[model samples]
Target: MTFLAVARLGRYTAAAEVLGLNHSTVSRRIAMLDASMGGRTLVRTAGGWEITDLGRRAMAAAESIEASLRALGEQAGGDPVQGMVRVAAPEAFTSAFLVPAVARLHRAHPGLAVELLAATQRVRQNRSGVDLEIVVGRPQVHRAYATPVCDYSLRLYATADYLARAGEPRTVDELAQHPLIYYVESSLQVDDLDRAVQRLPASPPSIRSTSVFAHVEATAAGAGIGVLPDFLAEHDQRLVAVLPDDYAHPLSYWAVVRDGPRSTAVAATLNALDEHVRSVGVG
Candidate 1:
């Protein structure tokens, strides 16, 4: 179990946290497993632990055992819908959607726990430790299930004060004369978002950040016109849409689940998220 956790999470500290054990204990167990296996199974890398070929074989066997145990638990009525389910998603989605969904899940199943990894990146083929990922655009993955969760719009927005001072651009071509605020071009990983940014008039952004919240904040503070998600900016009274009909960019959010039999807890979390998205359509 310790080896499985480390292999899935790629970090001793993260494995320890999930397993409710100390870091030292997790390390010691891995060391013992390596000794018993007669060779190294994991190696530390800049990203995290890289599983060796031996580790992959060991992981396969361990997973089979885990599946068997879970089935046994279910047959005996010993397994409850409770445990940790780790998810990776965009920062804005985490704050705007998943947080509330989890809150509702907790109210019903207090024993369940969820760890949200706020990120904006493509889903990895290996997946590391994330059970589910909410990614922008449809995900291309091997041996995983990808489903569309929701579609949201991104539109140009500027503060009323900024528009008053600088005047709002009426057309996409006119937008080139005004400064723009958006994600840093160099570090943006999502192809869909990058394509949208590339379609905009070619002008260096006045401000760039990895966080969508920052874009909204900067736009709200009169920094510059920002290409922001409708779900986030539409509710802010300070911001007004710029050419809403002409400049709207539609983006879809997809949920990618690792291929396997999901535990009851993970299934419940997925269901909660789906329910929440259905209840409040992403604007």
Candidate 2:
């Protein structure tokens, strides 16, 4: 189990946490395994450990065994409807939108538990840690099952107080005269966001951050104008939309599941998300 965890997460500390072992223990076990095989299974790197060719073969065999065990456990049912479902998505969406939707899903199915990995890092379909992913743009995994789950709009916003103080700028060119807040250039992961950046005025923003939450907070503090997702700012009375219809950037959210026989629980979770998108106005 320790080896499997390490192989799956590719990080000793993460594997240790999942397996309830010390970091040193996880490393020691891997070292022991390598010594027993009289070959290096994983090569240590500054970032993390990478599997050797032999380790890849061994991991493949281990995965097959794990799959077999899972199949045997599922013999009593078609697919599991109760258990943990790990979903990865951007932090902004998780806090602003998905939290309430997932809460509803949990209320309907009390036995199901959802593990949310809310971060900027993109989760891959082949990654063993996550069961589903809500991707911002097109997923790179071609073989994975992917579909557009929802559409949301982003528009310029400023605090009501800020607008009152600075005066509202009606057009893009007028908006440029005021201070702005935006994402850092290097941190942009979505192609569509780059286009949005292109639409910005030639003036540089007064504030920049890699986190969407920061952008929202800074904008709300009357620091500068910010482009934020409608779902996040729409409910906050403090924020007023700036040229919403004219400058709104349309974006689609995609749900991706690894290519394989999905469990009943996963199917239900996907269904719930689809329903939420349709029924609940995300924006």
Highest TM-score among the candidates is held by which one? 1
Task: Compose the digit string of candidate 2's lDDT tens values, residues 1-283.
Answer: 5666665455787677666689999889988988877898877655456577888777777767766866776795544456666788888778766677778888877878888987555545344466678877666774468887777877899998999898898888887788878778787777776667587786544788888889899999999898888888888788888877669788877788764325556777888777776787652
Q: Which lDDT value does model 2 have at 206?
A: 79
lDDT for 262 in candidate 1 is 53
Q: Model 1: how far is 85 from its true place, Å?
A: 2.1
Question: Per-model C-alpha lDDT, please?
Answer: 0.84, 0.74
- Measured over all alpha carbons after superposition, the RMSD of each candidate to the real structure, in angstroms, is 3.2, 4.6
TM values, all candidates:
0.82, 0.71
Worst 10 residues of 2 by lDDT: 119-128
Question: What alpha-carbon RMSD in Å does predicted model 1 have with respect to the real structure?
Answer: 3.2
> What clash pairs does model 2 have?
none
Show where candidate 2 strays beyond 4 Å. 1-79, 108-111, 121-128
Number of clashing pairs, model 1?
A: 0
